[model samples]
Every structure is written in structure tokens, then in C-alpha cells.
Target: MKQIQRFFLVSLTALLLTVFTGTWPTIFKAVARSSNPVYVAQSLNDLAPILQQLPTSVRDRLTTFISGDELYRQGDAEGAAAFYRQVKPDFEVSDTQILEPIYEAEALSPESLADWQQAQLALDDDDEAGAIEALQSLVDREPAFIPAPVQLAELLMEEDEEDEAIAVLEEAATLHPYSTEIIMAQVETLADEKEYLEASIAAREFALLNLDHPQAPEFQALADEYFEKFSKRRRRRSIFGAIGNLAAGILTGDRVPWESWNSAVETAELVELMLASESEFGASLAAEYREQLPLVEDPDVVDYVTQLGLEVAQLMGRDFDYEFYVVQDSVMNAFALPGGKIFVNSGLILGANSQAELAGVLAHEAAHSVLSHGIQSFFRDDMLSQFADEVPLGEFATGLLSLQYSRNQERQADILGTRVLATAGYAADGLRNFMATLVAMTESAPPEYLSSHPNSESRVAYLEEMIQRNGYNRYALEGVDKHLAIQAKLS
Candidate 1:
């Protein structure tokens, strides 16, 4: 037992000697086996001097780089730029040699080029701050390289680091105002960020200065268009300031006002009580029963609706491929979907007498598409989803009593469509006459679908008033069925 104890003491002494002598391979292997607090505390104490020796600027740069990298990785480009620029580099080891006295002696060597290439690689890897730091090092070594600042500015712009990008570009532009590409890029960025007024001023300045250049004419034309659009938008906003407040609750992200919510409830209750429930569709049935629905594939029928659609769009001053689809349902309906998709029910077609009358209804729905009214109307209602079992149907169909667009919205579309149809070389008579026919139908055989879009005697008269004022409109719409070659054989 005494021999065993002596042998253990000798082995313990040897281990302590190995640890104290800094033979870390053996010590570390042993440490890999246990958590020893004394060694950890001693190790940290030894690092204190090393930590103190690091330059404050280098420390700051490292901290900032790490934090900014986190932000950049998270897709917060603007935020990352903010953190990155806080770095104040401390590189006291730079050469004491001044280049002014010995220009070629101090000119950038291949080593400097290698550094530039390194920065470029970091940029290519999507590490903007890393690239900036690398490029900045090259810039410090060779202070006159134009590529460094310009490239940094461009990368910053792409990352939406607008303010920082602008600061860099502005300085570069001061030196090279003739670079149209750089100037235009900055202007585009400003415009996309909704700094339109500033962009317009910059565009005007560029246009005026470059008037003698070949591209100046193009720039001037674009500047003039921007000026006109912004000018008109400003005037419109000024005119509708009061109306903006009244309806803004529904248009913006703010909470819906109590008054608006109450109005919605009241309107819904009114619709629930008074709206027809698909029972008032007899006139539509008669119109369809007397005449077999015109085939959608009928060349004459397609040609007729397309011509009217084009005529209507022209009047509205919108350039769109106007199309009319025959849904074939004997429902008194017409709808405008996104991207000029217009559907007119065969029932609405047979219900009308004159080609002009049918043209009016088609034109009105076309106006809805052009003015984006249908999209806006959708945003205002039906933001709900309900289903029963596997089938989907509304408890109350929407068309029966849509609170007809506010009279103002209706009047706006009417005046706009009237002008469009008249300008497109189509007679406004179709629009007016159709409204009048609908009025007559309203009195004689009111279709359930017509309730929400109740015929206004005043509206038909209003179209006539516009025609008399605009003076017997004369425009012709030209359309050809480019798809007639593709109609599948029907039995």
C-alpha cells in the first residue's frame, strides 16, 4: 500500500510539471476530459493583456462588421449601411512614404491590384460591407483609384442603401457630371423611392445641361412627361382634398372609422331586406326564350362587340386590347375583370334593340376597367370567405342590390365613358339609347339584376346632354377576330 501511494504521488508530480511547463498538447488532452474552473479563470486572465493591445478602431470595426453582417443577412439593407459606416479605421502601420515627391516610386504595385481584386470577389459574394472594407484598404494604399468609390456607391444603391448611395454618387457626380449613366441611375433610384419632385428637378437640370447631346432630346421629352403627370396629380389632389378625407378610412391601413362601420352595417341590412332574390329574372328569360343566344363564335357577333369595345376604350383615352366575351348565361349581366377581360351575358345582348344601345352597355363596363373602378369596388366589399360542406355559394348574391356606386362615382364613369366613346368615333347614342331602353324595361319588366344598377332617367338624359355639348359624336372602332382560326368543332 505504501509503494502504491508513493507511485501515485510521483505520477501526480509529473502531470503538474507538464501542465506548468506549458506542454499544452498533453494538458489540453487531459483538460478535454473535465471542466476545470481554475484553469479557465487563469486562461482568461492571461488573455487580458492581449485584449488591451488591440487598437480601439480595429476593435470597433470588427464589432460593427459583425453586427452589420447580421443585419445585411436579415435583408435590412438600409439598416446595415447605418451600422457599417460607424467604423473608424485605425491603421497606423501604413507606409510613411509620401507619393507627391516620388510619384512612380509610390505608384500602385501588383500587390495593390491584388487587393482590389480581393474586394471585387467579396462584392461578387454579396458581402457589401466586407467588400467596402477591402476596397477601403486599397483606397487607403492608393488614394486615387476612381473604381473603388463608384463601385461601392452602385452596390449600395442596389441594396437600397439610398442615402449612403446618394452621398457617394453626389460626390462622384461632382467630378464626372458628363456620365449620363450614373446620373440617370441616381434619378431612377430617387423616383422609385418616391422622391418624384427631387427626381424631376434633377431630370430638368440634366436635360437643360445636356441639350446639345444626342440623347438630350429623349431626356427632355421624359422630363416634360413627368412634369405634366406630377402637375396634373397635384391639381387633382388639391381639388379632391375634402373627398379624400371622407373616404380615406376604407382606402388606407388605419382602423375603419365607427361612422364607416355603422354605414356598412346599415347598407348590409338594407340589402338583406329589400334586394330581390333571383325572382325578378323573368324579362331576361323572355329575351333569351324568344331568341336563341347569339353564338360567341359567330364572327359577326364577336366583330360587333369588339368594334364597340375598341370604340369605347378609345373614347376613354386608354390603349387596351378591348374584348367582349359571351358567357351564354341568360342573365342580365356584364362584368369587367383585370387586364381588360370583359364579359357580357347573352341576355343583356338580346334585351337591347339597336346596336348602339348594346354598344352603350359594353362601353360602360369598359369604362369600369379603364378607370380601375371594378378593382376598387372589390376592395371595398366581399373581403370575406364562407363555404358550406364542399360547395361555395353566397347567402345573398351581390348583384341584386349593390349599393350602386356613390352617385359621384357613377357620374364620373358616365362622363368619362361618354367622352371615350365619342372620341373613339362611336356615337354616344348607343350609351344614351341603352339607358333609355333600360329605363323602359325597369318600368315594364324589372330584372332582379337591374335593381342595384337601377336605371336612372336622369342618366340617359345626361348622356344626351353630353352628346349635344360634344356635338353628334362620330367615331368608328375597328376590330378583327385574330382567334377565329382556333374555334374548336362543336356538335
Candidate 2:
């Protein structure tokens, strides 16, 4: 068994290397003939990072090569032939490096290219109807021609046919699941229609589809934004549902079950409900997390941490009870679980320079809970359940390591966290300073902050904007001596 596993690993590695070094046709054939083609496809897709880091010309050539293979698989023999013939003459490939100047290669066949160019010309001429007709015809002829569907969908939107546009994009997504443009259009259109649940799901699927793409971080940020918006909508619905349940109970002369609403459920209450067969999900999972994660033992330290968290929560006008735990780990990390369970790593606490700094971090985690990030994490439509079940925990961990908040959610957190810090009588600079430090930390070692957060520069800039726009006091609270005392306890 061990030998077989070792052989599989070696073969997969070789196949991945061939995907980079060999000609397009050879790599395509190899992937097509593989026992587990999906695995082969993913392994090659992992080359996105390396492909992105290459020179622009090289990346373009690689894209052309892949496009050629895609055309071939779609039965466009002439297009495939053109790409194959052009590869060697345009550039000399020596040891996986392009050795000479290369002419631009065609990713589309001559015939299709001419049609697509004509459609573009029509659109430029303010001939929306003509552009739509041409692009629609082009897509009808070649459903796999990704550009046609994207253009057609855009033109459809211009004609105030958003539903039809979404349909066109959806079909294109099915055919060209890896087409970034198509997936993006579908998600944006869904969002524009306030179909946030569908938009969030689409964004997440796109992120998973192109996990290593150069724009993957952007995709994740989009997903986070969608999920956050969906959560807000869900919260509103839950509030209404609770109200309805209350009215129904009064009329029926029965006790209202407030927990029946789709609001966040407390772990203890959920466990009891499950024991009584009143909950759908197992309470054991929640208990497992609470029991397995190591917690700080010192009463004074725990009390102080809880006090600080409550102060921030109160500042945000959150009336619900919040539980804060200090995890006895060395990683500079913190996270919020469902139902207001927030965990702060001891390392994070020790590394803080001031109470305000610590407060900023705490406030940010609180925002995740407040924003319903944990709830969104488990949300699945029937379409996604099968895919979700197939993914291994280890594979899932990679996505989580980048941190789960979308770019929008992160921005919201940064904005709200700054407000919470200021409202709680702390300097607003605390979060900004922490983010700046994190940006630097990313260069030396992977910190927990980066694990599920967006790129630091954007985060820091937006945070600074919020602080300046709000005119929050940057030098309000230091609590340096008090922070040092907390550090002393841990030391």
C-alpha cells in the first residue's frame, strides 16, 4: 500500500512538471488519458501561481497553448492545428523557458476570431442589436467559444434583459467553468438582482474552480462579500420569522419557540435541543470544538479578556452575550466561532503593544461573528452539497488558511472594528498599526492574520481611509502599562 501510494505521488508530480514543460497537445493527451482526469486537471491548474509569476509574454504563450488544447477537446481541429503549428516557430522552448522573441499566438481560430472581432466592432459602432445577434450566432456555432457568450451576455444586459443575460452567462459557465470572465459576469448580475444567495454560491464555486489563479484572491474577496450580504439578509428574515412565530403562538395559545427562528443558536441550548430531537444538526460538533481547543487556565487573564471583549461588543451596541476564550497556542491568531464564541491565541495577546492594539484585534473577530461569517461557512444549497462532501478536510484547510472573510467582509470589519475601537475609548490607529505590522510579518513568515485575510496593503489603505474620513482619535487610549501586565501573566 505504501509503495503504491509513493508511486502515485511520483507519477502525479511528473505529470505536473510535464504540464509546464511539454507542448500543449502532449499535456492535454496525458491529462485526458489519466485514470483520474479531474485530479490531473487540478494538479495542472495548481501551476497558475507559477504561470502568473512568469513574464507576460511567456504567460500569454502558455495561455495560447492551453486555449489550443481546449479548442482541440471541443473538436475545433483547425484551431488546434493552427496553435500547434504556431508554437514552435513563434518561440523556442528550451528547458521550460522561452528562448527567443515570440509573435502573438492565436487563442482562437481564424474564422471565429474574425467573427468575434466583427462583434466587437458592431458594439463599438453603438449597434447593440447587431452586436448581440452576431455574438449570439457565434456562441450558437461554438458553445465553447468563451468570449462570445460573455459578450452576448453583456449586450443582453444593455437591452434591459437581465434575466436572459444571466441565463446566457449561466450556460457559458456550464461549458467554460474555468472562464473567469463568464463566472464574474454571472456573479455580478446575480448580485445586481439581489439574488445574494445565488451570487455567494457562484462566487465560492468560482474561487474553488480557480483556486490558484492570479485573481483567486479577488474571487475569494467577492465570495466573502456575497456571503456577508446574504447573512445580513438572513438575519432580517430570522427577525421577521421570530415575530411571525410569536404572533402565531399567541393566537394558538401555545408557547413560542424562539429558537425555531433561523437566528444563531447558543451551543448549550443547541445541545439540549438536539438531545430533545429539536435540532437538525448534531450538537457534538460544537461540543467537540469547545472541548478540543486548548484554553488558558488563569482566572485573572480570562476575566480581563472577557471584560475587554464585552467593552468592544457594548460599544457596537450588541446586546447579546459574548464568550471570549484565550487559546493556549503560540500562533498569532484569533477566530470567532458561531454564536459569539471568540477565541484569541495567547501569542496574539503577548505580541500586542497596547490594550488598544488588542482591542482592535478583538473587535475585528467580533465583526466576523456579528457579520455571520461562521453561519455562512456552513451554508450549502443542494447544488453544492455533493461537491462539498467530496472535498477532503486537508484540501478544505488550504482555503481556510487564506481566511474565510471576503474582501467586502474584511473591509466591513475594518470599518466597523475601527468604529468599535473608537467607541470603546481606544485609539483607532490600533487596528491600522496591527495591519501594517502584519504586512511586514507576511514577508518573514506566514502569520495567522494572513491565513484568512485579504492582501494587507489594500486592507491597510481602506482602514486608514475610514479612520481619516470618520476623524476618529488616533491617540486616544494607549493602556501600555496595563497591556504589559497582561503579558507578564502569560510570561
Candidate 3:
């Protein structure tokens, strides 16, 4: 009877696939709502043909559900819960009957529950040490129990044992990487202790690792805030140190060259190396492209873009001699070279609805230069050694053109670019609104700019939040009339 029932279910599933390839959601719903869900789950292997006909996203969700069902039947409820959590937010199975196991697994067992209650009682009685002791023992016994460690960390923090509290949350995060609660706790603690860099890194890593999570943008924004704080603090220290060095030099009758500063010296060396000869990497490659690519010669058009770019570039906190040029291409594209050479396609100018939008694009490219993303990319892939060895300019240019910025790098640019845009008195949402335009354009065909710089709704949301959180004045400047005049010159 069992064999016959399994065969019948598989045959029915295959028939449904044959008849309803276009109605995949209906078919999956029917299967999930089957009266004998366990039997349907068991017969999933025999429905391989049907699964193959489904779209990849749907197929993946179904596969995850099937794996979770199998684990649940095998008595590993905890393991099943882990799998269910991934698909639970967006994919529902029989009104989340399939996801209920996660809630069940999250509950404490009788022994752990009693211990938790005791800790709460101690806290209520103002016995902080007792609560801490109880929570520590409970967490040690059941490391997977998330709340125990959280409570213990809170107690430790109240007792002014910040290091131990951070350690406790860190261990908990290692054990439960999926727990946003634990990670956020850790980030807040680090930020409270003024460990801005560490907090920024932690938040950024979480967002990068879990891009699909609903809270990813929030984490990314937090990372931006902390990183900005860190940068400001470092800048303050540098200024004071520079003043001290100047005074000492005057007293000792010895002057240090400004170019001898580590960052300036390193940047100067890189710039010199890149522009050393026609056969060298950066400048040679840029020159080769200039010969092939049609460029705008109208002084007005070029000057307009160069002036706007320089306006935003000054606010980027980098003192490089920034330069901008316009390419006679109908593709919405712009790119920055290793130093400060930026090329903007004519189409990008016509694509902008306002001057703020154009400034936003230029600022983003300038941020790439200011952040030294191109140079870092070369060093990261050890291409600098090749450049030193005098690799053929064509081959080196190929590598440079094909460089894809990591998601983290892209987010950093967006954050910094937005900051400079607002500081330059342009609308703070200029970059974000431009990204939304790209997102809309993607529905038809993706823009060339997006090919290199991926844009998404989450990225837009984060920029919006960053603007609002910092109280940036988005209504300050639109410059639509000025932008139209520039567009007219190109036309």
C-alpha cells in the first residue's frame, strides 16, 4: 500500500508539472497544502522531473523545504530550524506550518528555563552578581541558548566589565552567526566604548555576509556612521600631530618637507610611477584609450563638468589634483583612473535631470579616486608587482578596465560620495535618486554605469537613511537650469 501511494503521488506531481508550467506558484501551493504533507515530503525525490521544470528560485526554496522536512523527521529539530530560517521570511509553506519548528527549537528546555527564571529573579532582587553567575552557568551548559549569553553580557556590562561582556557576546556571535540580536548587541557595546573602527567593521561584515536580510541596509548605515566618526577622530589627531611637528622643527632649526608625510609620499610615488613613460601602466593606458575614444572638444562642455567635479572633489578630503574630461559616447558611463583622471560619457550628461545628479555621479567617481580603490585593487591582486616588472601596457590596461569593486568598496564610495555631495551644497539624494533611475532603467536594459556599479533598492534605502540620519539638506540645490544649459551644449 505504501509503495502504491508513493507511486501515485509522484505520478500526480509529474502530471501537474506537465499541465501547469506557467502556474508554478499554484502547483507549489497545492503541494504544500496537501493533507498528507509528510508523504508529499517523502515523495519529493521521485518528483525530480517536476522540480527540474520549476524556476531556479522556486526550485531552491522547495529543495530547502524538503531538506528541512527530512531533518525534522529524523529528530534533528534544531538542524531543521536552521534551514527553515533562510527561506521563512519570503517563502511560506502552508501558512508557515513548515516554519513552526523554528519557534519550537528556539524555546528553552525545562532545565534551561528554570535557570533563566532564577536569573530573572536575581535581577529583580537587585542581586547583579547572582544574576550574572546564574546566566554564565546556564550559557556554559547550553551554548546554543542565545538569550542566556545575552543576559549574561548585559549583567557584565552593568558591572563595568566591558571586556568580559564583549567576549561573551563575541562567543555567542560565533556560535550563532545568524543572530542579529547578538551581533547588534556586540556592535552597540563597541560603539559605546568608542571603538568606532571595530564597530564599523563588525556592522559592515554582517551586512556584506547577509545581503538578503531585511536589516542589511540598517547595518550598512550604522557602519557608515561609525566609519565617519573614526575618520574624523583620526583627522583631528593628524592635525594636532602636524602642528606639534611644525613647532619642534622651528625650535630645532630643522624643517621636514610636507611631501615626506607617509600618505602624501606614497601617493606621489604611485602617481610618478604611473605616469613615468608611455609604456607604463596607468597614464599610458589612459592615453591609449584617449586616442581610440572620441572626446568632446567644446571648451564650455568640458569646463562645466571639470568645475563641478572639482567642486565635489574638494569636499572629499583628498588633496589630489583632480581632473575630469568628457567622452563623446552615448552610454551612461563614467570611470576614474588610479590617480585623479575621470572620464564622463556625454550620454551621462544628457541622462541627468539636474546638475545635482551630474555632480552626484562625478562625486562617486571622485570617491573612488579619493579612497584609492583602483590602486588598492591592483595591490590586492598583486598586479603592482607586474606593473613594476614592466608588464605590457595593453595587458595591464585590460586588468585595470576589468577591475570589479567589491560590495564593501562600492558601499564605502556611496557613503563618502553622498557626504561630499551634501557638503558641496547639492541635494543629498542626488546619488540615490540617480541610482533609482538606474534601477528603473534595468527593467528595460541595464545602463553601462550599472554594469560596473551595481545598484539596488537596498542600496537606495541605505543612502536615504544616511541622509535623513545626518539631517542633510536635500532641498539646498537642484541646478536644473544650469544642467539644461550644459546638456544643450552637448546636443
What are the RMSD figures for all models against the true structure? Answer: 35.6, 20.9, 20.0
Of 1 and 3, the candidate ranking higher by lDDT:
3
Which residue pairs in candidate 1 collide? Answer: 315-420, 316-420, 356-430, 425-475, 425-476, 426-475
lDDT of 3 by residue, 1-491 (tens): 77456545644653443233211121332233333332211435644544554446656665665565456556675676576555433211221101111122238677777777889899999999989988887787667776677778888888999999988987776545456887799889989888776676667656744557999889889977886776566445445544554555556655454423443334334434553321243455577678768999988788889999999988765456677889999898999885567889998887675567789989888877765567556544656445432344555666686788766567767777887898887767778767766665676688898888875656776676666656876654555444544554564
Which runs in model 1 stand beyond 4 Å of their true positions? 1-295, 319-321, 382-404, 474-491
Please provide, for model 1 over 1-491, each residue's C-alpha lDDT reduced to its tens digit, 9 standing for 90 to 100: 77455544534533443233211001111222222212211122322332232234332333443454445446665675566445311112323321221123235578777777788788789888888777657655664455655666666777778887766555544333445665576566656665554455445445544456787766666555654554454445433532444366567745366654544444443222221211122222223322543546665456656776665565553445555667566566776543355667656665443344566677677666554444334334532212111111132233312434544345545665565555554335656555654565465477544664554666765555556644644222211011111111010
Q: Against the unseen true structure, what C-alpha lDDT does each candidate score?
A: 0.47, 0.59, 0.65
Residue 113 of model 3 has an lDDT of 71
Instruction: Give the C-alpha lDDT of model 1.
Output: 0.47
The predicted structure with the larger TM-score, 1 or 2, is 2
Candidate 2 residue-wise lDDT, 173-205, digit = tens: 654555677789888988987777567656665
TM per candidate comes to 0.35, 0.46, 0.47
Cα misplacement distance, residue 177 of candidate 1 (Å): 45
lDDT of 3 at 331: 91
Which regions in candidate 2 have their CA more than 4 angstroms from the true location?
1-286, 380-403
Model 3, TM vs. native: 0.47
